[model samples]
Target: MRAVVYDTYSQDLSSLEVREVPKPKVGPGTVLVKVKAAGVNPVDWKVMAGYLDPLMDAYFPVIPGWDVAGVVEAVGFDTPEFHVGDEVMAYARKDVVQGGTFAEYVVVPAKAVALKPAELSWEQAGGLPLAGGTAQRALDTLGDLDGKTLLVHGAAGGVGSLAVQLGVARGATVLGTASEKNFDFLRGLGAVPVAYGEGVVERVLEAAGGKVDAVADFVGEQLETTLAVLADGGKHVSIADGGVAEHGGRYVWVRPDGGETARLGELAASGALKVEVAQSFGLDQVAQAFALSQSGHVRGKLVIVP
Candidate 1:
């Protein structure tokens, strides 16, 4: 099988090579999937460049991706939940960064896989796992938002867009920060849009009528701003910044939860959630895909057809 492999961490794209590698053997309680598509995320490049070296282990010749959508080709021993030909999606991050979903085939724990929603295209399904799981984790960290007001920074991006829709579904009034170009996009997701540059606090205050009961920061470096606008005793969480914990807020690192992934699939199937694919590239063009993800300005998800 062919995959995108990196033998060492390098900022330059030269380290990534598309080449043949031995197929992964299925393990107990896991399923082997015939790869259809994979989602490109900023973390893929960041990890490749050694940003996460102190935190996670990277097995050399690593394949870089966590989000995948594909058809089940075989089930490992005792994995009775799925069989050959079941369409599925998963957040397939393992503790070690190897055997990722950037190839002709990949293996994932059955528990980490969710049946793909029939309503979603393969690209959307592949893009759904990581961002959707992050959004759901943010909402979970905040507890009940019913009848409250919430603010999301960078709400037009992959995770933020899903956060807006999920927040609104929980009966909270969601106000999202983005550029003027994405205000309409945020509004379309049921959020009141506030421009994120100068005077952002005042703009958000105006949009929320002077109340921000909670906040989820998808964009980093906003701890001070979050402290300024958040209501006293209100809750907040940041996925990008660890400094949030010092300010009485939580720092979230999204983890794979089969139950939560399944819930997200159900939401998409019911038409209550949507995923936007900003652009897609063939598997061999993964370097180009990573460049686009690193730009940090894409309005939605980027996917790779493998």
Candidate 2:
């Protein structure tokens, strides 16, 4: 199997290599997937560059991919949720040895996997787990969104895009910050688009008619600005580190939730939720994919097709 492998942490994307490696073996309560597509996320690059501390107990030469869409080629014993030949999508446990989905095959815990929606393509399914799950978790943490006004920063990026649609579905008046180019795209997702720049604070307030009920900062830099415009006692959440808490809001680190994944899958299947893939790369182009994600302006998820 050809997999992306990296040993050292560096800013350079070239450190990621597509090389032949032994295929992962399925264990009890696990399933082996023939990976169709793997989503590239900021965490993938961050862990690769040593921005986030890798677990000391885990071995090096890590394969850094959390979101995956693939077909189950084999299933482990005692797994009742799925069987062999199920098309599944998952966010693998961040602490696992085979976190690498940048390959032709990968193994994931059965509990982490969910049936991929029939309505979505492999690329779209690949983009959902991590970003979509994070968005779902953040929204869940903020009580009811019904009739509330919610603001999302970095609204054109992967998680923010999903957050926009999810907020709309929950009956929130969603306002989003994105570059001018993505204004229409954000609007199409049922959000009022505000240009993100020098006066983001004013723009959000203007869009919402006053202050918003809650804010989700997908872009970590605007934590203070978001907090300023939030209604008193309003909930604020962030996937980024420390900033949320520092701003007197909730800090969120996305974790795999099979139940949430199942709910999201149902929404995808029902055409209520949509996953956006901004770009696709072949497995051999893992380095290029990482570079694109690190460039900080990708409009949606970047996917590596194996």
Candidate 3:
């Protein structure tokens, strides 16, 4: 199997290489998936560059990716949940950095796998797990959004877009922060768009008619505005910034949860959620895909068709 691997941590995307590697063997309670598509996330590059070194362990020569949508080519012993030809998607992050989804195949625990929704394309399914689960986790931390006013920072990006739609689907009045160019995009997701930057608090206040009930910060550095516009006792969460914990808000780190991933798949299948693919790249373009994701300007997912 040909896979992308980086021998050492570095900021340069060129460190990633497509190399011929052994096809991963499945084990008990895990299944081997033939990769169809893999989603490129900022975390992929961040980890590759050693930004997460303190928090996680990394083995040399790591394959870089977590979000995958593929077909089950083989099931491991005692893995009765899926068979050899089932389509599946998973948040396939392991305990340590190695053997990721940016390859011809990945072996994921059966518990981390979900049957991909028939309504979603392979690209959409590949892009769904990580971002969708993150959005769901942040919302879950905020409690019930029904009839509440919710705000999302970075509402145009992958997780943020999903968060905006999920907030609306959960009956929240959603207000989102994005640049003017993406205002229409947010609005299409059923959110009231407020341009981010100077005076964002006032703009968010105006959009929400005052303080919002909860805020989910997808883009970091929104703590000041979040603190200013949150109603008394309002809930808040951030995925990008851990500093939120000091300010009465939680910093969320999404773990692989097949249950939550499947719930998101249901939402997409029911037409209550949409997964946007900003661009798709072939295996050799992994570096370019990583660069685009690192730009922080990608409106949707950057998928690698492997």
Candidate order by decreasing lDDT: 3, 1, 2
User: Which residue runs does candidate 2 get wrong by more than 4 Å?
Assistant: 54-57
* Model 2 weakest 10-residue run by lDDT: 51-60
- Candidate 2 displacement at residue 290 in angstroms: 1.0
Which tens-of-lDDT digit does each residue in 1-306 have in candidate 3?
A: 999999999998877899998999989999999999988888999999999899889998899999999999999889988999999999999889988999999999888999999999999999999999999999999999999999999999999999999999999999999999998888889999999999999998987899999999999999999999999989999999999999999999999978888999999999999999999998889999988887899998989999
Local distance difference test values of all predictions, in order: 0.91, 0.86, 0.93
Best by lDDT: 3
Q: What stretches of model 3 exceed 4 Å from their correct place?
A: none
Across 49-68, the per-residue lDDT of candidate 2 in tens digits comes to: 77666453335677778899
Estimated TM-score for each candidate:
0.98, 0.96, 0.99
Candidate 1 per-residue C-alpha lDDT over 1-306 given as tens digits, one digit per residue, 9 for 90 to 100: 999999999999867899999999999989999989898888899889999999888889899999999999999989999999999999998888888989999999888999998999999999999999999999999999999999999999999999999999999999999988998898899999988877988888888888599999999998877988999899999999999999899998888767778899999999899998899888789999888778788998999898
Candidate 1 has a TM-score of 0.98
> What lDDT score goes with residue 176 in model 1?
93
Could you tally the backbone clashes for each prediction?
Answer: 0, 0, 0
> Which has the higher lDDT value, candidate number 1 or candidate number 3?
3
Give per-model CA RMSD.
0.9, 1.4, 0.8
Q: Which residues of candidate 1, in runs, are more than 4 Å off? A: none
